[model samples]
Target: MEGHCLCGAVRFSAPDAKDIGVCHCGFCRRWGGGPLLATHCGTSVSFTGAERITVYASSGWAERAFCSQCGTHLYYRLLATGEYFIPAGTFESNDMVMTSQIYVDRKPDYYAFANETPMLTEQQVVEQYGFPPEDAKS
Candidate 1:
């Protein structure tokens, strides 16, 4: 899959994507003004114009990056496994499929998705990931 930053300053390619996941975690929701639709591109992503990207440590295990020029959210990357969960909208095509959602309990009642994907609550995400609950923080 091919994608680019909002200002075209950074371009990236993922050899393949496993699945798309929605993160309803408060941090994710606030980061992009809503849930983050992320595509799981496992550790094979390459980048061009890498110098223009700025990374912020969103959690102990992951960092979220964005293009400095345009403030476009780039990717949410796992620190240990190097796996990438990129924002789906950054891609040039809409081929990724949503399979699951995390922090479902954190999602507000004002909006809902009709996709009927399997959802996990904040506690469930922490259990499944076996990580600290920082990602579930509001």
Candidate 2:
């Protein structure tokens, strides 16, 4: 799968088009400007316009990449897990099949999950993603 940043300055590819979902954490809200519609791929994901991709160390273990020109949040990387979580909206097609919403408990209180998708809480993240308790404290 391939996608580009809003300004078209940054582009990336995901070899396997699986493990996609929405994240509703506070950090995601701030970085993504909304719920982070993301998809997970291996570290094989590469950037084309590397110079335009700016990274922000969002946490001790995670860093987020964005388009420097347009400030479009592109993806989040978990160094330990070697996972690339790219924004779904950036992709050309929304053919993402599997999904598992993370940080459900911390989701915005104003909105609710109207869809029938499975939701994961902080503890679930710790268990499923191997994120430690401290890491899941968002």
Compare the candidates by lDDT and give the number of the best one.
1
lDDT of 2 by residue, 1-138 (tens): 888888888888878675568888878876656778788776888888999888888787899888889988888999788688888788877667646788888787777655668888878987987766543444
Candidate 1 Cα errors over 4 Å, as ranges: 135-137
User: For this target, which candidate reaches the highest TM-score against the unseen true structure?
Assistant: 1
lDDT of each: 0.88, 0.79
Give the TM-scores of the predictions, in the order they appear: 0.93, 0.86
Instruction: Tell me the alpha-carbon RMSD of every candidate.
Output: 1.5, 2.3
In model 1, the clashing pairs are none
**Which ten contiguous residues of candidate 1 have the minimum total lDDT?**
129-138
In the range 41-122, model 1's lDDT, one tens digit per residue, is 8899999999999999988788999999999999999899999989989998876788999889888999998888899987
For model 2, what is the error of residue 138's alpha carbon versus the real structure, in angstroms, after optimal superposition? 6.3
Error of 2 at 95 (Å): 2.1
Please list the residue runs of candidate 2 whose C-alpha ends up more than 4 Å from where it truly belongs after superposition.
Answer: 133-138
